[model samples]
Target: MVDIEKKIIEIIKHKPVILKKIYELLQAENKEDRRLIRKTAKKMLSDGIAYKDSKNKYHLVSSKQVVGTIEFTKSGNMAFLSDKNGDEIAITVENSLNAMHKDRVLIEKIGQWRDLPSGRVIRILNNEIERIVGQFQKKKMFGFVIPLNGKINYDFYISPENMNNAKEGEIVEVEILKHKSKNKNPEGKIIKILGKPGDPSIDLPIIITKHGLPNPGEFPKKVMEEALKIPEKISKKEFKGRKDFRDQLIFTIDGDTAKDFDDAVGLKKLNNGNYELGVHIADVSHYVNDNSDLNKEAYKRSTSIYLINTVIPMLPHELSDWICSLVQDEDRLTMSLIMEINKDGDVVKSNIYNGIINSKKRLTYSKANKILENNADENLMEEIGFLKETLESMKELMYIIRENRKRRGSILDIESGEVYFEFDENGYVKDILKRERGISEKIIEEFMIKANETVAEFFDIKGLPFIYRVHENPDGEMLIQLKNYLEILGIKFKIPETMHPKVLQEILEKTKDHPLNESIQKLLVRSMKRAIYSNNNIGHFGLASNSYTHFTSPIRRYPDLIVHKMLKKYIEGKNDLKKQDIEKYSKILPDISESCSKKERVADEAEWDLIDMKKIEYIRKHIGEKYEVFVTGVTKFGLFVEIPEKMINGLIHISELDDYFIYNERDNSLVGDKTKKTYRVGDKIKAVVAKADKLTLQVDFIPYENYIKINKKNTKNYFNKKNKNGNKKTFKKKGKNK
Candidate 1:
């Protein structure tokens, strides 16, 4: 068969051939030989080694043709596919050939488009869009569903019978009945009605349904049953070989609303004056046995999705929020990492073992920060007085560890830009606030980093099959782009061919006091690749660590659960690993890592979408309100502005200016052609909200001067500003000049 395949490939490589001609060329027309030849040719076509044209002629796949997954841009205007050599080729909407996002397709290189390699999808090997979440719109006779996912351009056609009694404006999940084609929209039946738009209850469901994640607080019956079978209280049998730490001064620090306490911390001063730091993570592996329904469900979810107030957990609430959560004053099983560190923050010795812990207290970051900064009130200080010494020592050690991380060239001080929401009595968002990471957050972060690194190093030295959280270095092209962007801000630095985190660290330090620090950091972050879980250990570029893995938060993250199980097996084997177990793990870990990475991305995107939706919803109530915003970005189409007070970003179109504007690429500015007005990063302007769309997650703003011009009769007595030309009729700002 191999010989026959080779002959067929060789024949087709020279020139495209019909089946009969190939048989004639090879002279293998016998019954058995014909069967084998035809089978081999079919296999080659399916495996992308060859492709059959419309004329039923076979041709070998060459550099001119590539087979890969189609990745669509957010707006669905363009797509990208990678060749065998991992080079990206752009595919415009017209050339997409109706291929959906993530669909495997074969594309032929047509030519160059916009200075990049371009292609047209010739054939789709796989159709990945089976279900879609969209808004149902009823027409005169029938209805269609408009997809909420920005990457899917076509509206799903729904006949009158397939409407499933769904309302006109309700969000619905559609099961694709027929795929889209050149002239026909995809046909689907409404399978589920999520809810109506603007209903606070439906916000999360929209994102959840769109991403195909498990609905919040819901799990499979079998998985839930299995979780219910696990004992809520620790049994004597479970305590075997586990060290006892119930009497230790251990505690958990998380957000005020956080219910799943996955890790607890403890500290003590060693005999030699070194600091002993203890990180106890919930032993979820003990309960979620391999090959069990609970384990399978955990793997399916991969990681918990935190969408503001709702949490779609990997494990059921019976496990994640109960038995496995390190609730205060409750005995629970855990895997503990004990490390002895010197004053310089170097871990001289470390130990990992099964253990039991009783969290003495549950503290929120706000209260913990107050204790750490000595700003706690009298009653609060007295209540935590017993933990005073340990808390102070923990704070001191956090800074030391942070400094050590800095010494090793870790990129730190990047703002998270996380936001929190305040809700009205009716569950509607009333205000959005920025979440500030304080000392207590840093303490937990540093400790988890050390613990994860220690466990990874231990397994790395033993050469065991393991999963690693790896962040590869930024691409050279993206770094060049970053350099160009930085130069526009008057910060010029040459990026090296082989860049290090420290180099970026130094650049961040240079911008520490710059007004555009957040924007700069966000740009640099975009220039870097997203961190992912991988079976291969390539080291983590962001953390500047030679070894790293997710060892904490097993209750929320599946990778951590897997790490716990792997660590247990290695420890039980006492460094004498078995060949069969290693072989089994080595085969499965790669797929598991890839699945987890993909799921993690989906969770992040869902969370971001929900947040952006809520932000738009909040802005909708104040449509005519004016805000002082900073120009965070400038382009030919518009200026990207952020309201610092609210931490919400919006766009002011170039046409919104009083005069036509030209984009100056060198200075990264938009200049008004007539007024000589300029808008650049860090420039502040007053703007009024022009529009906000929850569907697109976009906020549009126009200068206040334009708003005044449109409403001069109502505001003529209030505005007393003059333009640069000394015209009292013109205000400094304008609205909706477009």
Candidate 2:
């Protein structure tokens, strides 16, 4: 029988015949011999060493074929071939048994149908993931872990001995031991136990896992010790050959809670009736040299992560907050952009140099705004008398510059807002507010903008290699959609064939005082592409500049530090930057920019997640209570409503809309089929807190028609009456009284 099985296997291996033919060829007079051949063939087929083609022919898979990575979706697996232009092939779970998400696998194109590709995973080239987050479960004798991240759908069956003291209901980091195989679930071992489920601290790990970011581990002892050794004082030798601006009345302006002051500004009326505007940034690169421990740590962080009440700084507090920070009344080394601007705000002359600066005072935006509004304190009023005069002159120059910018088709009127959190002594949020644009913020912004533009232009004229912040124009399809949406609201928006910043700015200005201003501004921002760092100058669309780069805030931004280094090299006449090096930097800049951007997004997500959790807790106490909400976002799934009083937003799912209509994606609305009732984006409505789920951090809202409709009608009447007065003037709409 063994001899017969061996003979049959050999024949099958060498035969290029159909299964029917092979079966016929392997025919034996005795039933025992035939059964043996059949069993062997079945085993070989199951092993994937052989496959049946469309014609039912059995053959060995060719070794030299296509290879690529497999990306797993919620439904199944799709193999992305190595050819840059090749269409990805779909792989069924039966054939993708061993492959995991982002794992490199050898794919053999079995066939193609109507331009769609089909393939099987012949071999898994590489396994991309080593650790994953999951919930641990226990059986009678063994355990199983289910991944929280849906991308890793498979459960890992763990032996009881390998449970590593992790209890049921505990979230943990699991190390993959073996991928999915024929007779077992993917095996894994518990590496580290995260906290109990539903803990607020678990949000950090979840976000980190979702974004594939590194966990915050203890700093290396050597790195920490070296960072501790950084001196607190600026050395005299460090100031050699550098420009000195210590006598300049430079002052730092930031949020009241801000710790690290990276930038300062000084404005004065020059002898020639021009304005001397000095923008100085901390000289971080001077202390953090290349290949040093501090530099390595900064590069690893890439950017700071600011959560609700915590900031994970890129550099340690010793350096970021004290040593490098431009603290008030403290002398610090800095890289300065000194611009001599005429009354028209045109840059007449500019100089970039390393310098020493003393921040004469630390000003908060509130104080500055108060002073600008003529409500300054006695001491502040005295101290800022000359400064206010200088600022008034600078303001005039800025307006001229701004007018010139607008005339040059610049997009300078984009709406932006920051979330304000009022925290108690314990760093818990007492209140949350939306911080909008103010004159003080605008003044600082204008100065910083002028400084950045001047430095960028200088670099361009010098033909130096520096990282520029570039934003490309929006895609045609997005702009068309935006135009159509605006038209639906009776708003006239003309998007050019080649969408430019000026067109966007014009639309924003037109809608600045509209009821849907926030919604429209958000949509406009969404329509534009994200700005990124690059060596080549593509120009900035948001800033409406032909060339722009980060030349301010070197204390926090790595690109600004790099820009400073380049400026220094240029000033020293050492223009030895090779084209290839610049090209390399160009290529590398995008990846770094993407990484930093991802971190920023993660930080935002973490902060929002915590806030959402807190909001859920806050609303739980107010269940059955009503509040005025503005419809901020609309989707087929649900509407997002922002509670203006608390500055918290929650979703009103489609199922909870009380039989209102199907969603209209085109108009961003929901309309009833029978009544023709419509709920549109940016419409203010009163809603009662129906449900607050702490586990999900979800708040469900149900519309309070009786409370909202009355106020809405009154608002409409007031607007109509105001319009009847022949005044096409801007007016603020008040929400309904709760």
Candidate 3:
């Protein structure tokens, strides 16, 4: 069979040959040989070793043709195809051949465009975007829904019959029926009406639908039944083989509004003066059996989606919020990672085990921080004064761990902002504040990092097939760009041949006192690769850890639950496993890793969409009001500015400026041609909210002086409706969500 397959490939290697020609070349006389050749050719085609053209001729897949998934920029005017090796080839909209974002397509290279390989889509292998969430607009006889997702440039036409009684201006979900032709829009039907756009309650739901996430409180009936069938109260028999930590002064420190306490921490000073840190994570894997409906649903979701105040949990609320949550004074089962740390903050010894713990307190970050800072209120101090010594010791140990991490080249100064909404009684946002991470948050973070690394290192050393959280090194090109930018900023830094996180850490340290410190840190972060899960272990770059995995939030993250299950198996078998089972895990874990990574990205996008909407909503209430903002981005068309206090970014169009501004690519600045004024990243200026549209999720800003002086002028038609050259308007039309 192998000989026949090799012969068939040789027959079609150099030229496009039909099946009959290959069959004849092989000299197959028997019916079995013919069937085998036919099967081999089909398998080769599917496996990308061979490609079949329109005329039913097969050629080597490497013959100027490739398979990849297409993605578009947010503006949708340009697209790129990313092949399996992460190499991207540019594809113009015209050459895209009507292929949408995320469509797997076969492309043939045409020629080089701007020195990069460009391609035209020859065939679309598959399009998985079956449903779209959009806003409906009814015309005389029919209606069309404009997609809210920025990647989709075209609209879905909804005929009168397919409208499903959807009203005008309603947000609806559309199921694509067919793609008519290259230039025509796809046809679809309205499947569900979300709500009006500006309604506060509808914003989150729209984002949820747009990202294909399950709505809040919506779970499959069988999954819910399974969740209910689990006993709410822990029975005595369930405590078998579990270590008891109920008498320890263990507690959880989360946000004030947090309900699901997945991990609790405790610290102790050992006889030799080393510290024992206990990180008890909720034992979600205990109740969620691998073959059960709950497990299926959990794996489908992979991780909980936290959209503003709404949480679409992977597990049913019965498990995520009730029995599995480590509430105060309540006994809960956990998978504990107890590590013994010396004064040098090294994990000298560690152990993982099933444990039962009754958390002594449920402390918020604010409360814990107050106690650490010795600023707690009298009543609060009186209530938990007994735990102060342990809490202070934990704080001291946290610094030790953090210093150790810093010594090992971890990049820790990157600032990620979280926009927290303060809602009124009617659920409208009254204000938005950027949540700051305090010392208490850092304590939990450091402990969780250590725990994850310990478990992952254990399994990694045992040479077991297990999932790992990996963050690869940044691309060399991006590091070069970053170095150039830093040089432009006058902060000279050398780029090593082999990049290391410590170099980035040193650059950040240099910018610690710079005016653009925060912006520079953000730019550095953007240059780094996103951390993801994989069955193969790659050292994490950002944390500077050799082995890492998510093992601290099982109730919220499915991978952590799986980690718990793997740890339990290791404990039971002492790393002994059947050869077949090892092969089974090795085969299946890669797919699981890919699925979880994809789902995690979806969850992040959904959360960001919701936050962007809320930011627009909050800005709308203060339109025409002036605020101090910093220019974070400079483009040919505009300057992207962010209000530091609110953590909201908006655009100040070039047309709004008094003089004609030319984009300086050398320094990424906008310089006035005549006035000699310049605007660049990190430049502070006062700007007024010119416009905020919820439907488009855009916020436009105008300079404070310009806003006051040209209050009645039409800024879009400014400069006498033309630029300096008088060819046309310089500012381009705003693409949806661009």
Candidate 4:
């Protein structure tokens, strides 16, 4: 077998283009012979001496040639290779189709169409995880496993003897026993059964597997023991060289369900008439020392995963929830940003320090909102009077600062939505709510922004190596598409070549009262580039600021924690690190940022998926009932409508539209070719629930005739004119009598 593998490697090295035919020939054999050949081929491929073509053809790529990680879709047939240059190349599932997601593979470019290079996976650089979470099933004498994640499209063939204790409909983890060939599914054996389908506990296993994230249960006891050793109470020695702000009336504002409080704010009127606002963030780095068990665990997880009903913290409960948490009345260590701002919200003086703080109050946004509206309880009124006054003063300062940001061309006011969950004691969602933006959220946001900007500016002045939160300008193509979409809606908004944040803000301001404000805002956000962490201080496009960095909430966000460390290092005049060290840090910072961002997105998707499942469950009883909906998306296959009252979305299939016959991509509408009836994105309509699939979390809808009638009557003249001038006029006469 070893000699055969060596022969295969030599053959590929000599004639790489013949890999496809060779593999095919080897596969078209008896079972025992094929197994032997496959083992040899697998070993040879793993050596990285050859490459595969997009067509599944094999060829030899040089040992020093380009290679990258390959991620497979569930189908096990196709894969995408992410190269060192950040370019992803698509590969057919056939030739080297056995490679899984995140498997490093060597590739040799085979051809090109125009400027697009095409390649194939020649050698498997590494194998992905052998274990996967799926559901077990039996069909007569045979058994199979269906993967929980859509990305893992291939079903595993499970032998009866290796079924373990898994029963039909039981969610279980499976270990791959054998690789797939041209005519067979990969063989697997059930290892552990999780729970029955639709069980809430099943969700965590599914989510963990789906995103390829490690299970929290895997945390070592050593790490847990180390985490427990960290002191919960503040000590004099720990507070050495730290400023004391325990006497200040600082407070934390978070959600009702929030356990870990990481940030606190305090405001005071300075003698010079300027406001001295302090943003204090929990200093997790102080206790979770570098290279320690707790630090290692936190670094591995990167960020906490906030699901609908649970928060999977990066640090264990000892640190994330109890010890380092900035709970009210508890003396906690914090990295503080003390800034002096004039009446116009212009920064006059700023300083960063390691400090001890005592939070005076812990407030929820809802309660704060009520109090700010002057509808406060007796005790609340007395306890929160100073904080309320400070909040009002902060609001005034924020408005001025916001205006200044706008004048400077910052891109603010993107329409963003937050999903709120009402959970049962069992950890299941009772209800899902779309949290609306309010003054309370804005107050916190404004302070965080001011703190971040101040820190960035301070680091810039010091000429230090620091991580900055930067957002580059949007891609030219995306901007053009945005402009085109706006033009289609008869909205004249020009996106400059070098666009500023103020331009976006202006557009939002102009369309604030418009019916399509939400739609336009969504488009604007989609067109912008994502913000990332980097050592270089490029300006943030979304904030419309020249320089920005994450300096707030160091306890939860790793980048902010890194920023604090760098700031402290610079403040102490430790200029020992070299240019090479800075460059090395800069290169890895982007990767870390990208990884953390991906994890955040995965968490978001999992949360959405769970909520969608709960939503389907909630609406199950309402099938066939009608609700008012707004068209949120339009595609060739269907129109997506969201129930405005509940924010639940369903698809109105193209076939379900009896009146509208033509799909128009230009205006994003479905039109009746004969009657010229139109249903466009952002247009309000009534839709009846047609079907709901619990397994897929898909909701189907059909138009409500009564609502359509009302819509038609409201825009009678517009529809009449459109009908008279449309191409539908030619088909009108032929279809009317039929």
Candidate 5:
């Protein structure tokens, strides 16, 4: 068989010939040889090894060709596409099928001359984007909207009829009409004109509309009216059959700007030497009835969107802020989870109840941290002794809970510090600061996670229908890539006997304090599957839990509201919760989960865009200002630097480097080809802000004129192994949340 296959290939080496010609050329006189030839030809064609075109001639499929999703770089010079089989291929923009970033495409290998194969797009399987955010420019009869995002290389052509009277040079949202052949550009229509791109208030609206996010202005009036009708004051009749915790010293802790507080905490020591910890979440489901206008609106939005300048809430303010918020000194409906925890952080007993509470006080993270860390308030210490003890006891309990969680192999990704923006009276940026998560934030987080776990366990044991938050195990191929990258950073950990969360958590801890910590963590996070809502109990791999669901923050998230309703029904003596309503929801929960997850991602992207725009605007004014920055990445063309104060990254272009430099592929560094000077990853240098482009989110930096190159002795090939595809020195992937 092997001899026949090779002989046949040699016979047709130069060109594809007719099958009749092949049968004659082979001199097959007997039926046996003829049968073997036909069998081989059929096998080759069926397995994609050979194919016959319209002319009825056979040809071998070119090597290294496949179909995958094409991801673009910020500059659009090159593209990489990867499929589920772990195969990756690269192609140049010229070979791209006008495939926008993240679009699926069919590609064929053009050459194998280089170590890595180069491909050309044959067909586009899917164009994932439907619209874009851009600036409109009027033409003679029509117009073009230039995409603000750099990955979108094509400008959308718009006709005058679809312009909607948009002015020239205004930021606008355009809906994509068509994206035809590779030779043609994508066409679109102007749906909304957001004022000037630099306008603080106007840009946000354009982003929201561009992403198709829910808008507060378009909220249903029926839902608004129903929310307003909910009384501010709690009536006596509404408190019946509800546990009243108004006398308890329950209070809320949140950010200083938080208005719609969702969860509150109270703690006390039991006479039996145990502790009773209460986690009370606002009963938003009580006010927003099932299948009502308010409920439907909340389901549509799925999650509240917090942006730089404003919030797009999941529910109207009348319900989220005024009626359901756990405000201080106000009666609010709540669903409380009271756990009696022993000294070892084990729950001895637990109960869930429909309750009412009046918060004693509202504490901000700053003040709460002070009370935990400082013992200087003498006058208030005597009067607020209980408050102090409550906090101290809570801290003790938090330690035990956190320790137990770590033991359970829960993975924590404390990767990046949040860049917080404070605006001036005129809506311009006043200050930018990096806010590290402190103990106060963890106190609330630990308790909420415990409560959610408890609720999920209760439902699971009773065999009830419920919505769960599940994160599947990370992709093995991605993990292998991550492990290779970590080895480059001089970090190491066990890969587990098979695959689990503990080993990843161990690696996460080892990457801290180094300059590459944030980037490494980000890469590891990108390797893992996204956490999502589901009815099937797959168990959360990241949390390392047997059962888990979101049972807190119903005021800001819809799934929590659903959980609240279920809890209420079960606590009211229907423990199994196997009613017709439960069965109906169980059937549709998969679709609901999918829709909510997609919207959550959209909300996240929109929020990030708003922040990125504001950051660029704020940084642009500081052009020519020099600041020290750490070298987070060393690319073929430039060095990527992260500013300490702003926590934002900018590029130090190779052209900006005084001496001409050549990229060193093996070491992930750059060397002055003539001067013998070098720049390595993790080095600190000062550079002036050369440019900050809001439209493209591009920031460039240049070294100070007098700054000298370190030229320090360094290791060789530190970043030697490029990610999976043929070790291209310029292997780069752009976009965020990775």
Candidate 6:
């Protein structure tokens, strides 16, 4: 109703409306009008937007309100950007938009709207996005491209000549050429024609184009020729001034399908009873020269875009898959972070230096875990006795470090759902399963975290300008709302006067194994602020680390690449950076961080959309099949049920219920008014898939009895989990209507 009121105000602002007469007009404006218009008509009178006339008909108020867009140019420090919706400015300048030009958005600069002195400038602190990408559909006369990005909210009108010879149904990248007015569709032009959407080879390209990804054409001629000239193997000459770690029994651990190994690890027990752990990362900076075309391409991409069955690498195949990859038995260049950890997991000493390494073997998580249990392939273990011993020692150190982090209030082990599909040899959907992580994954994670943290602390102590992964404290208001939400769910908890990581950890510990833990965990994560890149050292509230920066996987992440370059300069004793240089970087870093963050977000959305799209396609086949679902949310219309294993949420519409249901505003549940039966949220129930629409990415479910059922065993339906007390509680009818 609030949304309808807002929409009505926006429409009425243009002209006075005969409320009853405009019913069809309002309905035609949006597809969701059926649900919204009913409440809007009533809300209009209550909100004073409409009044009864002499004839007893409703009339809209003469003075109307609408949101408009604005763009601002800076006059010194204060930056302002306007919205498409008028003079209203909501430019939240992040640290990345500090010195952006008029062409760029002034993202993340917080400003007040009430009243301000003339010319008062504002500094930046956050960011937003620009440009949209979509699919091109040609018409008989003038063509229009439907945007794949929902945020754009409008189709792009493409001129015949501007189609760039793209055929119909091709996934072409369209750039907004002109925005004449808010009412008119923006004119666009085809910048790149990827290919037909359904083609096997075009899958990755379509996702890339839809997200405006920069997968620059097969390395420029010069870059490729240069890459070819670089010798494949690192000789003794190239290892000058670098610590020699080739004989240190180093090994790479990754998934079985992994092609690129950017990181490797080694371990040794020193005589002093301290464990010496070495995290050797591929020296991508050593190969990709700063300001080179290869480097520039990597910078533009910012980070690797990995999707289902496809990976768009930031670096070329020549580097990412070969030269820069720490392949087993091949001598490769590396930047090593060697640390001595005492029995208590405290870092007694550490050093970051360039080095050379030869990976002894590559082990997947499953294989590595088996090796840890001494139940792996015997031939290799027999040949490499030290490898097995070192892995065990590494496992020991991982646990010690993990416990140390937990003691310091670091919240690292938050469980989340993952779904992945398996395809057959012919590319048909073979199976989809929930992916799980084990101790093998954690061992590698523990090592990487240590490396990244140590590198960040080193640069911070040196007072150098670097991009830090900063997670600000959660909003005070948001936490209060979350506390209230939990209380409503019958979980009473107290919020600390001073918010800390331990506060959340304690509440989560209390909620562990509770019936509502899954949803509560997700909501808690939603309440927390998103981690973003910033040049300022505000500390990462999530990790409980005062120093945190991305220093691993330079081949994939731009910030890591930048960190490697800075680290190289300092480590090589070439630290001639001055205050002016630092100031110059201060302005430039904001834009870089903002751009990188936006690019990463774009990639994430594209990946998630593809994942959801396929999942919907998979679920559509199970229509009419009955499955157990847990009620995760309650609405006026229905109960929202979530398939536990798949993490798929679907709505069980109230209309689909056998009995007449009334929405209970008090408990936020659907109540059977006559029968005095209630269907409260968090209640488990059996439901049948009534409908699944890919276009809306929505699944509709019906109560098991109301829907036509099918054999559940054939579909492998997973049952709901039991409570901590090992009780599987079933609701007969919300406990006799409360």
The clash count of every prediction, one per candidate, is 5, 0, 0, 17, 0, 28
Off by over 4 Å in 3: 1-68, 109-117, 165-167, 475-481, 575-578, 708-738
Q: How high a TM-score does candidate 1 get?
A: 0.86
lDDT of 4 by residue, 169-189 (tens): 788888888766568898998
TM-score of each: 0.86, 0.74, 0.86, 0.81, 0.74, 0.73
List model 5 lDDT by residue over 1-738, tens digit each.
Answer: 556666667766568876766678888788888888888776555344555555767665555556566877767677876533334567888888678876766678777424556788876656777878888988999999998766678888898899999988888888889985556678898887777766777767767755667665458789888877888888999899889999999999899889899999999999988889999999998898987899998898999998864788988888888889999989999998999988777788999889999998887776677778874377555544457778888888888888878888888655456788888887888778887776778889889989999999988987778889988889875676576556656677446656778887887777677767666665577678888888888899988898999999898888898889888778765555647767776766765776677578778878887887888778866664678887777788889987866877889888667667988765667889778888866567887666676777777876754222221222132223343212213212222211
lDDT of 1 by residue, 29-58 (tens): 699888888988987875568877768888
How much lDDT does candidate 3 score?
Answer: 0.84
Off by over 4 Å in 1: 1-68, 82-89, 108-117, 165-168, 193-195, 475-489, 709-711, 714-738
The per-prediction CA RMSD against the true structure, in angstroms, equals 6.4, 14.0, 6.1, 9.9, 13.4, 15.4
Model 6 lDDT per residue over 152-205, tens place: 445789998888988876667776677524357768888887665433355555
Stretches > 4 Å off in candidate 2: 1-218, 379-387, 391-404, 409-415, 422-430, 574-617, 644-647, 663-668, 692-698, 705-738
Q: Model 3 over residues 400-434: C-alpha lDDT tens digits?
A: 99999999999888877876898888877889987
Model 5 scores a C-alpha lDDT of 0.77
Deviating ranges (above 4 Å) for candidate 5: 1-132, 149-153, 159-168, 173-193, 375-386, 412-416, 475-491, 507-529, 579-582, 633-639, 652-683, 702-738
Model 6: residues with Cα > 4 Å off, grouped in runs? 1-145, 157-183, 187-205, 215-217, 377-386, 488-490, 574-584, 631-641, 651-683, 703-738
lDDT of 2 by residue, 89-162 (tens): 76666667577776766677777634557677776656777877777888889899887655565789988878
Supply the TM-score for candidate 4: 0.81
